[model samples]
Target: MNINKYTKTDLYKIANNLLWTWDFEVRELFKKIDSEKWETTVNNPIKLLDEIDETEVVKLFNDNDFLSLFEKVNHKLDDYLKNKSWYAKNLNTEKDLKIAYFSAEFGLTECIRIYSGGLGVLSGDHLKSASDLGLPLVGVGLLYSNGYFQQKLDKDGWQNEFYIIEDFNKLPIELQLDENKKPIIVKIKIADEIISIQVWKLIIGRIELYLLDTDIKPNSKKNREITETLYGGDIETRI
Candidate 1:
């Protein structure tokens, strides 16, 4: 990724190919995702792109499944970064330094929810901006089965909240096993109830981020879905 000459399309294509490579792995990793998961999640890249663009990134997300996976729009930030020339200017910042940033939403692009909206996309852009400048920041967020909800305007221009659950175990987001072949699991206490958040680590270019999900067992029925609704609901989901 030569930042200097890379257009927005180039970056989008790079991301699209990375995802397509992962599509090959899902077939072998989780042998039996519900047929809907298989078709809806794993088998639909263009659909995901359109979904994100429609709901999050760009407002008009009228993209079709067969459309080019290239990001033809939004060179605004790129132009600014080039003008800043921060990547080349900040040599000292790249000297083995590290920074960690946490956020609830990450719409990486309209094409990828891993980064969601201004907050999330801004988070993603920050990550991108950092990378371009070779800055040391690790963006952190949950590897949600579905990261965020998308609200759309109807003909009436009112809003609707649409839930999109991702099959993280099968997509660009996945877990890495330790030498002992175990997926990392971390436990936390919320409102005096024991909640376990399974950690799924994802490699984002040069950065590494661990995502937490409470949608697994070993948790009480109450805790099993604690993370389902982000930023809302009581943490006292005790059984």
Candidate 2:
């Protein structure tokens, strides 16, 4: 990005903190910086920064109003990250105990539309709330290439379904990487065949949500389509 000039600044860190979902000030700063781009990019600060003009960003960095708000928001984020919650100091759950939450879908935001209906939205809210409460929670779900189908009415009032395949690389998602800096591959047996699943990580505040993708190269054609769409196919597919 040739942003080394501003990469060393704490402003970069603040802009990259997706945890701004939980903070109003930080979210406002990004929006204020460029409301038009913010809306176009689905409130994704990282993408907004990436696509925004570097000259404009440099001007914002030098602006006194932007600098003032940036400092305040940055401090707020630092405090939030360091603050030891009551759950941390008082709650005594088993040290090795970890909570695993599984859901058919999650509607975290419209930008990443891997959800359908209210159940998905509810599941996403649960994960967000759990993270806010500082619970040791993990979410498991399948990553659909074509999330939920978009519905449109035909001339005769029949519903037409269309799917929008999103480019995951451009999205804010991060592929779970191992010590060797390669994607962590997980293998499991399904029926009599061994299938490989690639894990993708999404950050929901302090919590980590892991999604399994069966569309990797190691899987068979049929197996690769397992994670193609949400609520797709017949009862066998559901099973």
Candidate 3:
């Protein structure tokens, strides 16, 4: 199916944003499209959209009940974004001020497993809170290709580790583009080598979270894996 046709619609806009992660009504609308696909995709709307065929998409958009709920959720998101909060009213003088939050991992949602434990959860919550309060805040973190490990037990009662590779295209993230439509790249020096990095942006309500990635072609394989695992590398890799 040609998913590009619906890219300009409100459904695509709502699905692309992380706001649906916290909103039950918005999630329900996605579930209404295909409940089995929704569950299989782990509540990831982007993946759900890709999996549905044209017939399913047509039936869904043509349903009156579905459209009603869709409009309600869309309006809720619009109002939430437009409404001012305490930060706006009290910190009007600090309009030029912006905060950058840095963390090794962020547990924004289950589908995006860039986080591992408690610290990551706390950092994710901080971003969400800041967004809700209308604070001019942005989050910075590394994009892990492996994103921690999935643990399983063997017959001998021992633990085993397996890493799952993430496809960024299926996730609700957008690659940062420059004015010329090229990817915006950042270069940093580590010892004698200069590592090239690309940025991915994830929307958290009104706030934006920028994730740094080093999996570009300009870097060596070793350097490309620098952002591979979350807290799974040696001291050298950690550095």
Candidate 4:
């Protein structure tokens, strides 16, 4: 579909940012568009936008009530981004302090489920809390192509595991680019072989989270799959 025509809408703005994750009104706005799609996508606004029909899009655009709510939520997000927070007001120093937090997985939202358990949840919460607090913090984590496994049950009540490969293009993340407009890649030697890593950026409110990925053409098949799964494979994969 030609989504460019709708890019100027506030819906796209809200969908691209994780701020909608915490903003109830934004979530409600999305649900207002299509409740079934919202639930099926696990409250993912990006996917919802893609699935919504053009007729619905046109109808919503012409809707006065929808426009009013969109304006309200958009303004709120604007104010949040432009206004100074506690850290900015109280901490006045010549040099700005920045912190980098590293974790194996981050459970930011259900749609972007790279997290496996409590640790991922805690890490995700930390990033959200940091964003809310207006701290100059950056999160570092791995971008698993398949992320975690989805649970299923057989007719006999047996448990089954399935991995869903995520399309990063559909997700709320941007690839890091260099001055040449090429993807910014870093290389590091792991044992006898050198691994090339591509960087992806995930924005959380005012905070920035950088995710590392080994899934690229420069790397070998085995190395490319290094970031394919979360908490999967042997200890060698963990490294």
**Backbone atom clashes (below 3 Å) for every candidate:** 6, 0, 0, 0
Instruction: Tell me the spans in candidate 4 whose CA falls farther than 4 Å from its real position.
Output: 1-9
Error of 4 at 166 (Å): 0.7
TM-score, per-candidate, Cα-based: 0.54, 0.86, 0.92, 0.93
Q: Model 3: how far is 85 from its true place, Å?
A: 2.5
lDDT of 1 at 149: 68
The TM-score ranking, best first, is: 4, 3, 2, 1
Higher-scoring candidate on lDDT, 1 or 3: 3
- Clashing residue pairs for model 2: none
**What does candidate 1's lDDT look like per residue over 82-179, in tens digits?**
45445446555556766888977665534345444467766665655565565556767765454566789999999988878765533545565667
Residues 1-239, candidate 3: write the lDDT tens digits.
22223322557789887888777898898999889988889888888888877676666666778767877988888998999877988876876898999999998888898999999999988988888888999999999999979899999999999999999999999999999999999999999999999999999988899999998988998899899988866899897
* lDDT value, residue 188 of candidate 4: 95
lDDT of 1 at 45: 42
Better of 1 and 2 by TM-score: 2
Model number with the top TM-score:
4
- RMSD to true structure for each model, in Å: 11.9, 3.3, 3.1, 3.1
Summing lDDT over every window of 10 consecutive residues in candidate 4, give the lowest-scoring window: 1-10
- Between candidates 1 and 2, the one scoring higher on lDDT is 2
